[model samples]
Target: MKDKLKKLIIIPAYNESECIEKTIENIQKNAKDFDYIIINDCSTDNTREICERNGFHIINLPVNLGIGGAVQTGYIYGIRCGYDMAVQVDGDGQHDAAFLQKMAECLEETGADMVIGSRFIEKQGFQSTGARRIGIRFFTWLIRLMTGKTVTDPTSGLRMVNRKVMAKFAKDYPKDYPEPETAVTVLHCGMKIKEIPVVMKERAGGVSSISMQKSVYYMVKVSMAIIIERMRRRK
Candidate 1:
């Protein structure tokens, strides 16, 4: 790992106490070389206690920042710590650590600023709910039509990025459903992006923050955000 660029895994947890340990264990077993930071987003559960007792490296936020803020904090830390690359993985144990190496390799070999671990690239694994799948397809078509880049899993949380992208994201990142809109920013900045086939499992514990009602709001918000991003000048 030292021979290559130093990599950091950023796992953001809200109330993922039940699965955080297993998620870390998976990373330790499958990708031991990379370092990791768990952003405890002011969780009400024992997520912070588990991290403390286990001596896991973590940033205990003073407030309950949403997923975007937690992940951006990780990128900021990565830049400050001189990490050459950073990967965002959920703390709910849905993301597979085994795919981290492949994403890193894609980033290095293709010189892409970011490589998204996608479930739809090969049409395998949990394909999400019917309503969410419709939103994903709409965003996929929107991104392709706007940037001419086909991103099958724009909503995927598992993604890896080089230092250049880390710096950009650390400075400014969306605080909501950001994966799709952030991809627009990457393209507008003349950065390259790629997606690789990866399998994702269902969450190990705790309910997803996005309820069925919130899913409708998420789709509308992200769709509008991506459109507004397209109209903006390149940064």
Candidate 2:
């Protein structure tokens, strides 16, 4: 039965006990055909226990790996486990489980290497803070300049990647502000990428890991990193 499940949901959780259960339940209800793996990134809360108790497939990280590491771990796991595709969803409950099947279908039907769940494609939610929104727009333009495709929501955490991409990312993935940079990387590698309109909701619990002060740093740091990465690739 597990062999028949082609798509897997890779959720990276960090102190997400409050919402992880509900998120998992929703995914189970809405996307039953897909299996799920929760990468417990050294969460201080009861996230791991909750996942275990709920009979979810979980990988417990001994140390705290940030979002990028945790997600990449899931991708690696999915690739090794012979899954056809892996979709990344936030454990914070921001992502819509209902859209998983649609995204997976698009990935399979279009033969795209990556399918990004974009909030801005249809402009259907409180996307982000003012500064973050501006930052996302700027990064979107930057990614387009590099990739020759306009990605309206470059920072969206919800995305689906095929096994080929999973192999690539497992080998090398961006650590800081990975979402935007990864889209450019995938494009640079000559892989097909697509965006679909997906409605995102507000976090059901816990505060954001990215604070206002850190948001500024995130923008500048990620911009420089992307430029450097691009230049290196050119050489």
Candidate 3:
């Protein structure tokens, strides 16, 4: 019989005190066999205190490291803990953990190095709003234009990776604006990526401060970053 994969769910959270419990509970209910660690990005709110109170596995950053840094920390921790695979699940609870098992199975059964949960493939979930979707589609086009690979939802945060790819991310990952850039980086390294349709809900709690202008600027900056990433030859 084939051995079971040891999986770790890496949840990066900042000021997610209200949503962290629900996120973990979702994972616990949906992905019962996997272990998880919460990378608390030195939240000013009572995020850390709550995690401690609930006995959640958490690593509190001494300072804020942004999304990219927090996620990289999780990959490093997962690798150190000897997990065979690591899945990125956002703490704000947008990513529905119910699809996590399907993604893991896709990775193992199809020999895919990475699998992404895309809301576009089947259009089955709370897809991004109009403005937000413009950015998602822009990155989708940019990644395909540069890499010749179609990643329909390059901005989607729910992703899974095998150990080899996990180690690569642990060594070098984009600091911010990571999702699109890392997608390009993975293809550049000749890794196989697969996408599965999954439903995504709005954040379970908290609020986003990003305005329309900020979203436009975010698109321009990440487009340039993806181009730069595509140019660099992987060592």
In candidate 3, the residue pairs with backbone N, CA or C atoms under 3 Å apart (3 or more residues apart, or in different chains) clash, namely: none
Candidate 1 Cα lDDT to native: 0.92
Candidate lDDT scores, in order, read 0.92, 0.88, 0.89
What would the per-residue lDDT of candidate 1 be over residues 1-235, giving only the tens digit for each residue? 5456899999999999999999999999998779999999999999999999999999999999899999999999999999999999999989999999999889998999999999997878888888888888999999998888988999999999999999999999999788999998898788999999999998999779889889888988988888888887534
Candidate 3 TM-score over all chains jointly: 0.96
Candidate 3's C-alpha lDDT?
0.89
Question: Which 10-residue window in model 1 sums to the lowest lDDT?
Answer: 226-235
Question: Could you list the CA RMSD of all candidates, in the order they appear?
Answer: 1.4, 1.9, 1.5
The alpha-carbon deviation from the true structure for residue 81 of candidate 1, after best TM-score superposition, in angstroms, is: 0.1
Ranked by TM-score, top first: 1, 3, 2
Candidate 1 vs 2: which has more TM-score: 1
Clashing pairs in 2: none
Query: Of the pair 2 and 3, which is ahead by TM-score?
Result: 3
lDDT per residue for candidate 2 within 98-212, as digits (tens), equals: 9988888888789899999999988888687787788889998898787678888999999999889999989988765699888888887788998999999999997787898
Q: What digit string (tens of lDDT, one per residue) describes model 3 on residues 207-233?
A: 653566677667777888888877775
Better of 1 and 2 by lDDT: 1
